[model samples]
Target: MQRWERRLSDAAHALTNCGETYFEPDLFRRNVNQFLTIIRTVTFLIAKDKANIPDYEKWLSSAIGKYWSGDEVMLWAKESRNYIEKEGDLELFSSLSVALVYSYFTENDASIEIGRSELLSGGIKKLMRLAEAELPHGVSAAAAVKIERRWVANTLPNYELLQSMIYVYSRYRQACADLAEYLGIILSTTIPTAESIGEGEVHQRRVSYVKFSDKASYSKLTHRVEIDRTITPPIWLKDVDRTRPNFEVYAEMAERTFLHFGNHLAMVFVFSENGTILQHLAFTPFDQVDKFIFWRDLAERILYLRAESLIFVSESWVRKDPGLLTPIAQAEILGEMLHVHEIKRTGEVSHKAWDIERVGDQVSLAINDNDSLEASGFPNYLVPIREAFTRIHKR
Candidate 1:
């Protein structure tokens, strides 16, 4: 219990500090169910004291949200559950607290952003209020002197209690995940923490869950499972088709994408079927071949996902093996260098299109007469043969 209590404190602190939040609508609602389950089981020792319970219970319902059916409180267990279950938001409000409820039913970008804000502060705070109100040591001190039917008071362990509580809460959280169906497909990736990155150590990890939803749900979900000492986690999945031209896909997507507009750090938005506007920083150039391959493979994996795919990757991980995923934008970033590598490796050039301008045995790039480039620029684009040369030879 102490472990859970401390974690609950940690969660509260994190929430207060981080103003933003995200919640899968389904996951939010199922938790509400768990909350209700707890409330229903809390029986009173005194019948007269039960009278005051109705007023507090009614306040609990209304305080959580006006969305709930604002009606009189009933003590009957079966009837209480039945009425709540019939309510809206996928019947999420019936079991879960109103604070945790976010108004998300349709699958879209705007809806998610709005719901996330609510979940972070309003939802979490409300949940805390509910817990404190019911518990004997709660902030409001709402629970009366009568013995609780649901909670049996006993002398708890004095030492090493927090460790056991943590284990219990983890299972409870896992159980919540097991019992409730997450609304959309989750695409996740673990990015490296700054200090350990590029130092040859997997010293830190952070996972991003890109929840995708269509008319229905996807069968498999890969989550970022965290542990005590491990810094890097795992990536979601991989892209099987390696033969496709990655840049052509980018070139063709010119109409749908822009470099500067919208969520500019748009690498995360690659999984959306609708094109994304990426930030320039997201295109950060990498000289290390492995890191370049990793970033490119992440793009490839998301490109292949038909359902909402949650991606997970770390500093130590490129989404797939170097050869398995095609590097699109990554290629463009080092197109000339890669072209040179290919020529050096195979003793021939695969791309017959790029007008080659060689500077003393090293080949540079001249833009082809492709319509996309001709329209976008002043034309006559030149790329260096090797970035290591530290020189740009212009004609």
Candidate 2:
């Protein structure tokens, strides 16, 4: 077995054994059913026209039958439903489902290989095109409602419709994987120790690269880039009293240092010497409000753009409010940047600054730095940020 396969198998074994302690039989069945569903969906998408799909479905049904109607599946489904209702995020449910499906494929190489073959089949492409055609175009909200009404009047939950949706979603997931791979490559090249940072630190220092494109004045468009990084102080520094002469002097020193280099992306490397990166996040730019809306509906579009190599840095000011997702103002700027970058591929990198809440009363500020690098078809520029923590007492 390949290394990835072995890792997946080990994970499955661990999960199975753990389930055995609390509720063995039911949990086992539910897991098995989930695996079967993934295989069924992937294999079904592989067939050229639906000729061989029935056989695959039959096999999946049998496999699922062994686990379906089990208490574990019911319990998990209930929990999933509760999460969906509480969060009011359909994307969460879709993400969970996709993760489960991918887990199954990871465990079985033969099944995934077959599914890959089917995915590349011409029949699947035609099905994708048909589904795309069904989606509404530029029209008034009332007109869209009318179109949806007409669609619902004729549409039925038939096997063909289900199959087509599965195909499209599967393609989308594949595209995400491709984008991740490309980004990984670029990060590797640009950031020397991109993969060396531990996962824990990476999570703590999560930074997002949001790209923006312009809809109006497409010819004069440009890229808006932003960088978000986490910062923590050293233990010794934290131990010192905030009012102490040395402590106050050092605090001001650090703030000044941070602000002085805030506009420079190159400063991250220098800062890394003092701390670590928790996460490196990046996404493609959106062209307009409608495009942003579409992306919100299909989270996979972020991956699609990455795969196409149409990504740029977003300006810092656009992400001033850290909690919000895809701010409208930022989207507009990003759209313009995306448009301009597409044409020229080089320009002055814009920078901005913002602050993030830290563990105590102290706050950490980050400067959004920007740089335009030639596309090397890989993620060579992603430097993994390191985390540094310090404790500070109120004086």
Question: Which candidate leads the pack in TM-score?
Answer: 2
Q: Write the per-residue lDDT of candidate 2 for residues 209-274, one digit (tens) a residue.
A: 111121121111212233534657555345545554322333343444443444212111111111
* Candidate 2, run of 10 with poorest lDDT: 144-153
Q: Write the per-residue lDDT of candidate 1 for residues 1-395, one digit (tens) a residue.
A: 22222333333222222111112334433443343343333222112233433454553343222311321122222243445567522221111112211111111112111233234335434444554454333112211110000101022221111111222222233222221222132211221211111112110111111111111111112223244564532221122232444333432222122211211122222221122221111323232322222343333222112112221111111122223133322222322211111111111112222333446655444445452323433211011111101111110
Candidate 1: where is the Cα deviation over 4 Å?
1-271, 274-281, 285-293, 296-395
Report every candidate's CA lDDT. Answer: 0.24, 0.26
TM-score of each: 0.19, 0.20
Global fold similarity of model 2 (TM-score): 0.20
Query: Judged by lDDT, which candidate is best?
Result: 2
Clashing residue pair totals per candidate (backbone < 3 A): 21, 45
State the TM-score for model 1.
0.19
